[model samples]
Structures are given as C-alpha cells and as structure tokens.
Target: MQVDADFRPILGPQLVRLDPMRIKQLQDPLVYSSIDSLAKLSAHCLNLRAPLTTCEKLINSDNTLYLAWKFDEEQNVSRLLGFAKVGRKQLFLYDSQMQTYEGEILCLLDFYVHFSAQRQGVGKQLIDYLLAQEHAEPYQLALDNPSVTLLGFMSQKFGMSKPVWQNTNFVVFDELFQSFAAENGEKAPDGWNRPQTPRRIGAVSTDTRWLRNAVSGHQSKGNAMAAPVDADMTPQGALSNRAHQAKARKAHILSSKPLW
Candidate 1:
C-alpha cells in the first residue's frame, strides 16, 4: 500500500516526522546510533513486547507512519523526546442499526513520550497533529490496547470516555458507526436503525490525589477511585432515586452489549 499523502513529514514546533529518505540515512551507524538506542529505550520504557522498528523497517513499511517529538538541547543537538506509530487497518464496526460491517480506520499502535516528557502536552500535540493531518475526528480513530495513562489522556483531552463495544481488540468511540455511515452514504441494516436517546451516566468525581499517585509511579494506595454516585443521599432520597438508578443501569447494560 502506498503511504497516505497526509503522512508527509510534519515540522511543528514541538514535533517532527523526518523525510523517509532522511530516516533511511540513519542506517549508517556513525550517523544515528544514538537515535536507534533511544528508540529501544522508548519501547522498553513503554513496556512493549516487540522490538521497535528500525530505520530500514520504517522506510520500507508502506502502511505504518512514525512520528517523533523533537527537543533542542544545548549546542543545537536535537533529542528524540517521544514517538508515535499510526497505521491504517481494516476494522469491523457496528452500524446504527447494530449491524456488523467492515470499514477502514486509522489505528494508533504505539504512543510514548519519555517519562520526563509525560504530562507536558507532548502526547496531546502528537495526537492533535495526526487528527488534523488525516482529517479525521478523535472518535473515528481506533486505539490498540491503550494503557491507563493513555486512556486518561484521551478522556481528559478529547472527552472520549465511553467507547463502543467491539469484538475486536481495537477501541473506538460509540458514535463511530453513525458518523462513518453518514460520511459514506451507507444505510444501516433493516431493523437496526431505530432511534435511541443517548443516556447520560451520572457524573462521578475523580480523586485527583489518586490520579497523581498513579502518574508518579507510586504503589497506588488504592484504585483511582470515583466518588460513589449516591454517597451523600439520605435513605428517603435513595428510595426516591431508585427509578433513575434503574434507568442508568439499563442504559449501561445496553451500551455494554457486544455490537457484533
């Protein structure tokens, strides 16, 4: 497959994708031994099982696009602060009527910022750049087995909390099917297009201290907890809240059902 035109080198202030030829030039040990070493370090820090792509693989792989965040150190040397890997893949999706079908999607395969670079908006910049370059919405792209930090980043930065249930490993937002169908002129399978009101799960407050602990790699004292939905309600109020609770529970079950 040919690389998408939008995957061309991007030279933003915070990140860059070097030209494919330039990347190929790194095969020379004298030129890019440090960068190659950094790539291995990045993968190890992210707990990756497979080895990261070498410069040759990066240049030869038509489907995968690699991007790196750049930081200028003293003496004008550039450091690889972080990197991301994205690729197009065929995905099975659910239609508005809950029918299963195959579609093309961009998948975020690997994303990591150096531990020191985390929380400094480097990851966000990379994601935003990919979204804009591909002319795709955040919900349209899929993530491959995201880590807790990655999920939190998506939730905090893009409001992508509730993902659609899929048989595959990829995580995509619930609205993906509706938007995909609208853009493609495809109709949902018969009996599957019934209109349903979107349900809002009651907000649960997050413990900021717990989140901080998690981010700092501390042995979490406990889970990153959310306040109980009915923690402050009186007995009478709890009784009164039963109907709403039932409705929310039902919605949650329906939403969690396998779309396949």
Candidate 2:
C-alpha cells in the first residue's frame, strides 16, 4: 500500500531484512506503523480471521520479515510491495507413505503482496530475494498453513505439488521427505537447520560464566552445581543434542572461511 510519507529515505530501494534487533535499534515511528498496516493488508488478502503479524509479536520472536519496496512516482512516495515472514520451526512431519520424522525446517510462516502489487511479479521478487539470502530452494521450504492461492503459486512457480502432512499446521513437500529417506540414517549438518532446544523460563543457562569472570579478573568460588532442565517443558534428550550441535556450529564457524 502507498503511504503519504516517503520511506525511500528510510529503507532505500533494496530488499530489507526487518528483524527485532534492527527495528529496536532504528526507533523509527513510520517504519513500525507502515509494517503494521502491511501485515493487516496481508491478513485481509489471505482471508485470515485475524491479523497474523504485528510489531509486538515481531519483537518477541526470532522470525524475520523481508520486505520489497518500490518507488511509486504517481503517489510521490515509496510503497512496500510485500513481505515474507520466515523462521526455524521444529516439527514432526509425516510423508504420504506414512513415514514420520522429526526435524527443524526453515518455514514460510506468512507471505503476501499488497493488493495493489498483486500479479505484478512483486511476490516473485520477494521470493527470489528470500531464497537467495537463505541459500535455500523452494522444495527445501516448509509452509505454515498456506492458503490455496499460495499452494497454487508454489505449484506453478517451483513445481511443488502435494505436501507431506505434518502433525502441526506446517507442511513440507514430497521432495523433502524423499531427501530425508535417501540420506539413509545420515544426520544433516549442524548449520543446516536443526532443532535447538530453547532454554526454559526457570532454567539457568549453562553459559560461559567462568570465562567471562576470569576475563574481568574476578575470582570464582568453588564449583556450583548445574541446575536441571525442566523435563516437563523440554523434550527428552533434546538438551544434550542441542549442546552438542551448538559446539559443532561453533567449530564450523571457526573453520570456515569468510563469505564476505
């Protein structure tokens, strides 16, 4: 939708990554208001019962909203064409053949182009940019409760047909299920989207407190007992797996050369 004020001075003519930390630091009133309106527009276009996105929810979660902006000379302002919200989701996925598996996937949560920009390739532009940045293909993606329109779009654009059913709202296509089966018990790499158990509310994080204290020239007391994770909130063995994966990710980062 076209706004009265120009966002060109703010977002520029590029695909922008809108994350919690960036928005929190920028502190722009127009940015928040514009994004909120766009999200409502998205919900309306998709016939959702309620607005699926808001600044309040954005700041509280790990999801990223990617926006494609276009300068509308007729309106004398910059218009944001659409946005794609994505994040890592842990799910129990089921294939058509009844094979079940647990995996973490990059999920397409919500996607919509503004009514004014629909059918004008704005959606494709946003998707192309997202796929490039994520280093992912359409088949590798999971969709969260996609509308029929979106499902048709996937079929047309990426040849993605029937999806594997999920226990939750999310769904992955047959290609992903086939890939998992073909892997033959081999595990996916740490950086390639794996479930990381999030620390529970009351659980103290077993962080590198000793290292930090030592760097600050503070002497630590004798060893303190580690707090147990709340099993009620945590899946069994997930904590240990997450720890191991975290270490593996760290090692991979240190060993890999800089992409930039």
Candidate 3:
C-alpha cells in the first residue's frame, strides 16, 4: 500500500511480508550491507522498556524463529522504521520472575519504530498488517511496561482490553479479540483496518474443531468427527470459556498486585 505524504514518517512506502529465509537474509552481514545499522537499531529497541533480563533472552533466541522488520524505502537502502518478530513458543517468560503461559504463541517479541517514525502510524500499520496474515489466531503479543501504550492503542482500536499476563506485562487477547473485530469492525482511534479473511493457525479449514480433535489422539476418531461438540463443547461454549478465563485473569492481576 502506498504511504501518503501525511503518513510517510509514521509509515514506510510499503509493508513487505518476510518469511524465515528472508529475515535471515537481511540479518546476514554480507547481504544487507548494513548489519551494523540493523544491529544498532535492534539494540536500541532492546534497551527500551524491555528489562535487561528479557532482552538477553531475545538476543539468544533460537535460529529457526522468524523475524520481520518494517522499513521505509528512500533512495538506496531502506531505513529501519520499525520491526516485529513472530515464532511459535510453548511459553514466553517476559519478566524477571519467570512467569510462564501456554498456547502456540505468535509473539510480537520485538516492536520498535525509530525515533523519527513515532506517531505517523508505522507501529499501528505493522501490527494491523501482521494480524491480517493468513495465520492469525491463538497468537499472543507481550509488551513491556512502556510498550503498554501500544497495548492501549490496540485495545481502543480493536474494541478489546489488554490483559496483564503476570502483573509484570500485558498481552493482547489475540484469538478472541481478532474474532470480535472480524465479526464487528475496526474501532482504533486512527481508523486502522483489520485484516480480511481471518484464519486460525494450523487450521486446515473452517472445521478447526474436527482438525484439533484428530490431532489430540482421542481413541474414538469416528465418534469425535460425528459429534463436533460433546455435551461440553460448542462454538458458544468456546466463547464462554474465553470469557471466564479473561475474568479470572483480570481478577488475578488486579487483586494480586499493580502491573506497573
């Protein structure tokens, strides 16, 4: 998409979708020809609200994980405007206390816009675009205290509230909220758009219930497929489950301690 002149500083010329291989290519010293600059930019984000403890873990993250950065094309080399990294992790301990959580997490492990890129909408654009991707559900993005502002921005924009994970940081309730926004429409202050054609991660089709049961190794495969919902399972049931979980988590965070 073209970045209008008014939105140029906040957004780059276009949003490029990078896969694992492409991210590695850019990270390579020889290909990018600006490893030093990229490293510096990475370091700058590393130094922001992310505590030293959390930053170290990111620097040592596994090689297989995918990373995507947003850039503004000038003349020669593109400027590093902002970035986002996504990968599947069983748990992400984003604080010193080592609080853990579950699910196949597609983390927004790192999101940073250059000082010059603040407020034009680069961060919002990058995030909104990423959420619209082919695989969008069961994702959880953890943000540090300072990055909580982005959380608020997304909450108002998406008509969802940010849920604190461990009283140290907050996470956007990806699956449910995305479902809500898709069923509804964008509510963010900047008039950002939600991605069309939402798809949950690992979904073969709209029949995710059947797909999941088959993978879980239940003894009665035939019966499981026939009754997509047992007495306990249904689409409405899943929504109710999430609502209960959210309420419990909110109480846990607010009652236990201040998430400052």
Best by TM-score: 2
lDDT of 2 by residue, 181-241 (tens): 4754344433433222222223333211110001111122221233333344356466776
- Give a tens-digit lDDT track for model 1, residues 152-260: 8888999988766566767777666556555545443433332221211233332111100011222222323422223435677667679777887888788996322
Score candidate 2 by TM-score against the native: 0.68
- What residue pairs clash in candidate 2, if any at all? none
Which residue runs of candidate 1 sit more than 4 Å off their true CA positions?
A: 1-14, 18-22, 25-35, 64-66, 71-76, 94-98, 181-260
Instruction: Give TM-scores for every candidate, taking all chains together and pairing residue i with residue i.
Output: 0.57, 0.68, 0.44
Judged by whole-model lDDT over C-alpha atoms, candidate 1 comes out at 0.57
Name the top lDDT candidate: 2
- Model 3 gets an lDDT of 0.44
Show pairs that collide, candidate 1. 97-192
lDDT of 3 by residue, 147-247 (tens): 55656666766554635454435464544344434654433223222222122222222211111101122324334443442333567877897998798
Better of 2 and 3 by TM-score: 2
Off by more than 4 A, model 2: 183-260
Please state the error at residue 212 of candidate 3 in Å. Answer: 6.9
The positional error of residue 200 in candidate 2, measured at the CA in angstroms, is 28
Off by over 4 Å in 3: 1-13, 24-36, 45-77, 92-102, 137-146, 167-260
